[model samples]
Target: MNLGARHPGTEAAWATGEYIRHELERAGCRVWTQEFSYRGVRLRNVVGVLGEGKGPISLLGAHYDTRRLADRDVSYPTRPVPGANDGDSGVAVLLELARALDQERLANEVWLAFFDAEDQGGIDGWPWSVGASYMAANLPA
Candidate 1:
């Protein structure tokens, strides 16, 4: 997933979310897509749930979207970075954790959340962490 792009808020985000959902479901967990809004744009948070007990949910999150573009580098500021490390690295790690957790047993409910629009606001604009802010606002208090 290319998290850094002109429109990381586009189909790339959706595709990544879908892929995560597929993997989670394949691992035998129930998955749900949490939809939210960001600067008038619709965003998604893909959630995978494991275990049955309900109390305080343990939530793990990673942003799957990239910046609007690489405005950091002077040579190719307009280009998109692969975001293998920025985008998928944490998600990959969490996926592995989910797999392991599914294989064994857990005492609490685990929610793996892949948030969208996190990379939307880069250095100059609305600022990064959009997805996280949205999630925080929507999460149970």
Candidate 2:
């Protein structure tokens, strides 16, 4: 609840990324971030990993980007969602899972993917999942 609306390319978003990274590390997960730029906006994807099994990976994902404009709000269509509950709730769940599962002696690797630029759709001049698209296009070997 303390984290504010994490709009893409905003201070809140970056701070949230830092928070997720720190939390992942605190949970004993190997953590890293992927930085990408799309249409002049730079965004990040935070990833946390556990386990050493070298087979297929299991992924848990959540979008962390909040819509910059609450177009559906009757009173303040232009204002951002106060808490971005839809986005942040998933983050909270993943964080809790990361904390809970970090101690398990598992056989399969688990990855927690926090994606950005997911709530940008329908906003003028913005597209959805730009950060995720960039990550998928530039996946690591």
Candidate 3:
């Protein structure tokens, strides 16, 4: 559970992405990663599909990236945040739901969307929810 600070464009974030992919596979979902670039830096969003039917589509999303700097912290504005609740908590919930959900009995297709590059907003000309925006723009037809 001690994954350290998983900020975008960091090794910890990449490792965390790999862990999420493995967990999604183990939870009986077909998983994949969607790669995108921001400010010349490559990032990705992890997605897992729980069903293949043509019914409706349901998406469960959470960001996995933490801020590189704790700009909100008065004393440690330059330091990184541990992000236990900022981003990790949502990841935890999504992973648990992936494990608990029954894919076979689902009436609609469920997509577990773990996004990246979402927390470093307004810093260095970055915007919020970059990963989510990319995914939304590139959704399957």
Candidate 4:
């Protein structure tokens, strides 16, 4: 997947989304991509469904986009973070959970969502959760 920064509307961001989708699909979940726009930037959200039922849906979510600025590091303040834990850890958990759900039996429906452009706030021209808000407003099935 994208090892560099996954800023909004960037190629890296798109790659990141695809990686999540691939992993989810490999884990036996049916996946779909939701596309939306924010501040003239096109963003995508990946949704994966595990098992089938008509009850309350359980949602697992994580932001896959890396922050544009490494404001925490004084030496590399403007550089991008690898996001190994900040972004990858959450995604990794969901992916592994998806795999587990494949073997285990659950009553309710489970949804694995990878939200993009979430860590873009306070820098560049983007805001926090712009992509996520769009996804929430749309709230697809």
lDDT for each candidate structure: 0.74, 0.83, 0.90, 0.82
Off by over 4 Å in 2: 102-104
Model 4 earns a TM-score of 0.89
Clashes of 2: 0
- For residues 1-141, write the lDDT of model 4, one tens digit per residue: 545877778888888888888888888888988898777878898989887573688888998888879977889998887788988899899999988875346778888889988887878666788766877788854
Clashing pairs in 3: none
For every model shown, what is its TM-score relative to the native structure? Answer: 0.82, 0.90, 0.95, 0.89
**Model number with the top lDDT:** 3
lDDT (tens digit, per residue) of candidate 1 on 1-141: 343342445776777788889999987778887687766676788878888465558888887776667777799988776677777788898888778885345767888888777775644467677777767777654
Q: Worst lDDT window (10 residues) for model 4? A: 99-108
lDDT of 4 at 82: 77
Per-residue alpha-carbon lDDT of model 2 for 65-103, expressed as tens digits?
A: 888888999999999876546888898999998888844
Error of 4 at 95 (Å): 0.6
Residue 86, candidate 4: C-alpha displacement in angstroms:
0.8
- Decreasing lDDT order of the candidates: 3, 2, 4, 1
Clashing pairs in 1: 3-66, 4-66, 5-68
Clashes of 4: 0
> Between 3 and 4, whose lDDT is larger?
3
